[model samples]
Target: MLPRIHSKGNYQKQAQGNATARGNTARSHSSVRTTDSSKFSKLKEVLVNNLLKDYHRKNKKAGNDAIYLKAVEEVEKILTHGRLTDKQLKDLQRKFSAMDGIPEAAAVSDHAEQDSYPRRTEVDEVNSYRPQPPPTASTQTSPSKRRKQIDEWSVMTLYNDVKHYEEQKKMKEKVKNEQQRTREELAAQIEERKKQKAAVKEQERRVADEQRKKYEEWQQEMKLIENEKLQKLLEERKREAIELKRAQDRKKMQIEEDKKMRARATMEKRAQYEAVLKENEKVLERKRQQKQEERELDERLFRVQMEMAERQARTALAAENERARREQDRQLRLKAAERMGQEMENKAAEVERNIEERVQKAQDEQYRRDMERERNDRLRHDRIVKENNAFLQRQIQMQEEEKMRRKEEERLLAEEMKREAEAFKREQQRNKVLRHQQCMQQKAMLDKQRMMKDYYNENESAMTEIELRLNAPLLKQVVQEKPDLPGELASKINLN
Candidate 1:
């Protein structure tokens, strides 16, 4: 078994040496096989190292530490396996390229071709290692050097073919990764929208509850204010009625005192008039007696009769004067009573008018306040509803725009995928053509080598007889010509 080596520099050295000596050296089959195995191993080691470095450099900033560790583990496994198949190399290439956008290792073109040309295993055969030959005296290089150049060309061609396969695999994997990422992003957006809807509903419910609570509180406050106003108005009206009653009673008492003083003055004037009438009656009697004595005896009886009639007339006049005074006193008493009643009626009417006016004023004020409060509440409710509607409309518009943008992105992605598929198909056809050409060339070379070996085997005995017949005369001639040669030349020929 071949010893496993891990160092990069050593792998490179071994690869260079094996590649240079591949088909140029004249060595046994076992020696050639060993070199081939080592060459393939070195290629795998170099490819894995490059992939690892690229992955680390690109993903380090992204913080994909676990992914990097897994990659390292996978690389270790491949190295320990001691052999890398075309399929395994392709798989690794896809994973490495997709993970970090780094290019993958060279691989076989197809599964069928990979199975046909499987990697060779290291055998336990003991063969001596060969060193390259030194330059000859001739200025021209050896045929072995020319053959080595051709072998190197073939190896490079094989590496290019494998690289093409790896590139194709990586591209496919990268596309798949992009599609998956897009799906995840869409799902996250949908979840976010749902959460926003739930939150909006909760907010609206809270707002409605707050409004209801405020309205109820406002109603309670208004009721309290109205009740207080009613109490105050009732108390004020009661105070005003009491004041009016007190004023009416004061005026009525003043009118009654004035009537009593007038009645007493009228009684004193009647008694003074009666005393004056009595003094006048006594004087008139004395004058009538003197006139009778002077008239003489003949008319004495006639004068006495006249005096009696005069006394009767005087008595009737006194009776008529007394009745007129009594009738006048009765009329004055009736007028005073009527005036007092009229004054009382006027006061009662004025108080009624004042009370009606105050009540009407208070009712109008209350009605105006109620109207203003209702107007304010209506305006506030309208404003709140308008704001809510506008906000909902804006949210809906934004969601629609986002959906349109996502649709555009998906459409573009699909078109890009279609283009990639077509390009991949064309590349596969081209690689198939190239592989076929290389296969034909190899078959032709192998056929030519087999024909040359058959020709050499078939002509061997005949060529030996012909060469003897031809050399007999040359030998005779050389012997004859030997006597004419110099001593050193002759000695050398004799020794041979």
Candidate 2:
């Protein structure tokens, strides 16, 4: 049972090895599979000879014969069994070691191992992970004592290449960063624009709301105004109607009063006309009675006048006869008296002639004395009248002068008193004016203070009013007394 298990495990290992070998062979000969077997072998030989010569040149001291034998053995094993086991690989390595000057053959085996199992290096792994660096000048320069200069140049070139690469990388990074920033900025700006548009829409809505509110307010105010106007118009119309009613009432009252007055006047006129008619009838009756009495009186007067005229005529005739007789008698008596007077006058003339002589002498003496006495009396009376007249004239002149002096003194005194009164009045007026000015200034100050202050009292106003009233009375009194000069002067005269 152990042998069977061992054998089975060995068989599986062999089968896996055969499959790996066949896959390698088929992959190696895949290019030449389309050619004839002879040509394929010849191409394979040429490739192997070229590979060996390259290996020999890299290791000059390597024995070519030993390397060729080892290569032929490897070819035979691949041709016969199509594979080489680990033991067979070890045997071929020993064969290469047994040969002299076959260092190239070992190197070939090492190269084969390297090809099968590649080793990872830091440079290779770094190259794979990172990017490739540009070629530097050092790689192209010949090896010499001036190699350091080449190295420096290579280092500078390498630095420049690295710097350029870094710059390009930075530039790419910068470009990418800028693109990202630009995209972000665009997005942010779009968001901000959306916010601004929303804000503007809100503002517009608010404005529209405010406008609507204002319009509503305006409409309400207009309605109120219209109502007020309508009320005012209605009130005015009512007032007009009331006035029209009042006017009509007044007109009716006036017409009624006029009718009453006219009726009263007509009644009074009719009464007056009836009274006038009665008075006219009475006057006519009285006139008729007077006419009758006048006619009777006229007839009586005419009879009396005729009888008296006849009696007068008869008396005149008797008187004429008596007058004739009396005239004759008077003539006779006058003639007798004349004769007697002539006789007496003749006798008296004789006696009177004697007495006339003495009487004439006496009369002449008396007339002379009388004439002298009359002239003396006339002279005395004239002297007395002149003396009285002169005395009275002197007294009158003295009185007149005294009266004139008294009148002048009174006039001067009155004028002085008037001037003094006027002066006193002026002084009072000036003092009053000053007082008024002070009062006005005080009032103004008080008013200013009151204006500056927050409150006022009634006392100040009452005091101001009292002061004004007092001043008004005083001024009125002064003005009223100013025109009393003529009346005052007239009152001073003594008529007696």
Candidate lDDT scores, in order, read 0.47, 0.53
In candidate 2, position 289 carries an lDDT of 71
User: How do the residues 140-229 of candidate 2 rate in per-residue lDDT, one tens digit apiece?
Assistant: 363222212223433444454456557766986786677456545544654575577578667756765785677578658867976896
How much is the lDDT of residue 124 in candidate 1?
14
Which candidate tops TM-score? Answer: 2
Clashes of each: 1, 1
Candidate 1 steric clashes = 1
- Candidate maximizing lDDT: 2
lDDT of 1 by residue, 1-496 (tens): 1211111224346435443443222121211222242454334345544545544455543213333334444654454334568787667756665674322222222324546865432211111111223435442344323222224434544454356547745975685576456435544544564476467556755755675576567557756865786687578657756865675466456546544544454344334434433543443354335334433432443345445434544443453344345447666655554454455445444544554555456457545655764576566557645655675576567557756865776577568757866875686577668657755765675566557546644542221232234234443456665677767535543444
Worst 10 residues of 2 by lDDT: 1-10
* TM-score (C-alpha, index-matched) for candidate 1: 0.23
What TM-score goes with each of the models? 0.23, 0.27
